[model samples]
Target: MSEKNREGKRTARERMAAEREKHKAAEKRRRALIVGASVVCVLALAAVIGVIAANAGKDDSSDSEGPAVAPSGAQGEDSLVIPVGKAGAASTLVVWEDFRCPACKSFEDTYRSTIHELTDAGRLRVEYRLATIIDGNLGGTGSRSAANAAACAQDAGKFVDYHDVLYQNQPAETDDAFSENAKLFELAAKVEGLDTPAFRSCVEDGTHNSWVAKSNDAFRSGGFTGTPTVLLDGKNIYQDQSMTPEKLKQQVQEAAKG
Candidate 1:
């Protein structure tokens, strides 16, 4: 072969090699950019998730934060009962309730008027015993916290009003909004003169948390079915499907006559 032809062919081969190297370098840079972008996206997603988790936890009330103390005028075993109405009433209605329980709210909505009328007439006395069954079952602190807040209201002689207000504004069982102290105080504002500094302090400190816990323990030990366990003179009247508010009133009146 001619020398010029050989030189030309060698130059052409070198140029092709250089072009291939350039393409390889470009591909490596492209891969590096893709990897870097993916890492950045992952980190950003993690940060967003962290923020959401933190916000959720901020409002999640924890029932294990402090010792339980019974509220003023708390009666019955271990001072767990918050009594509404005169002590000497003819019929005693015992209620086991969870503020976060929807059934309890349903009961309240249905019989609140009848119960209040009877209580105000000094015919029936309601012994409200709080439970945290919802909290135990659903994995949250709203029940306990709300119970503690009710106990605080009991201390201020505003339990019945505050209790009704709570039921009126009870959140969904899964929402856990009552775990926030602010929400509790917000509901307290509904009860006339209930949002006192002492009340707020009591709720904030979970002053009755231990008492609430003990009440919940007692409820579990009692072998009750669920919240709104309304007993009229040792009978689970709430379980009586034929019974109504009128029937309850009649029964109470009959007992008063006896």
Candidate 2:
């Protein structure tokens, strides 16, 4: 064949291959769209079913006494209670946190810095409830253990500091995670003013077991359906994967201004 003709044929073959690739890509995208649509339809149907089930008056409340203290608007000086920012600060922010939740970890990393700044400036009071709802299901014993240790730290008057540390050093949601009991104790000791011996003993003996259970019970009662659920001034903050620090700051700002 003539060289020119050979080159033209080669180019035509390449174009055909490219066209085939494009066609395959389009088909793949169409299939993906179909799958995504089906998923959305299934989720919507499930949601409706869930609403019916929830309204069916099913008692999912765990058998335990309620939270140690109800979330009242009461304020106290020197009470270990979570502070409500400044006087007349629009809202009380309460976070129901599960240590083993990766999303909670992200929320902590995102909000900790800003919240600290606000707290330092006397602009917001943030309260936390360390619940273990995802314990056995997600992190198993490790989750429960970390929560237990946190409760001990709280008793030692280092709840806020130790709580931050727990979230900071949280392990993955797996069996291997609980192996860090020593690390948890180590972190707890770093909280100044905490009685290390007492904290360690409490963790070892599971002294805060009942309290943790009670907190979990209260978490359910407060309408918390998921971990890292945030309550701003007693209103729920609906969160999604795209929730950002700037958005949270704006929420806080709006709440503070009100």
Report, for every candidate in turn, its global Cα lDDT versus the true structure. Answer: 0.90, 0.67
- Candidate 2 least-lDDT 10 residues: 71-80
What TM-score, to 2 decimals, does candidate 1 have?
Answer: 0.75
TM-scores of the candidates are 0.75, 0.61
Model 1 stretches with alpha carbons more than 4 Å out? 1-67
Q: Which tens-of-lDDT digit does each residue in 125-202 have in candidate 1?
A: 999999988877787899988999999999999999999999999888798999899999899999999999999999
Off by over 4 Å in 2: 1-88, 193-195, 238-243, 254-258
Deviation in angstroms for 23 in model 2? Answer: 78
lDDT of 2 by residue, 32-114 (tens): 99999999999999999999986563222222333333222323322223443566565567777778888899888878887
Task: Report the Cα lDDT for residue 129, model 1.
Answer: 96
> Which candidate's lDDT is highest?
1
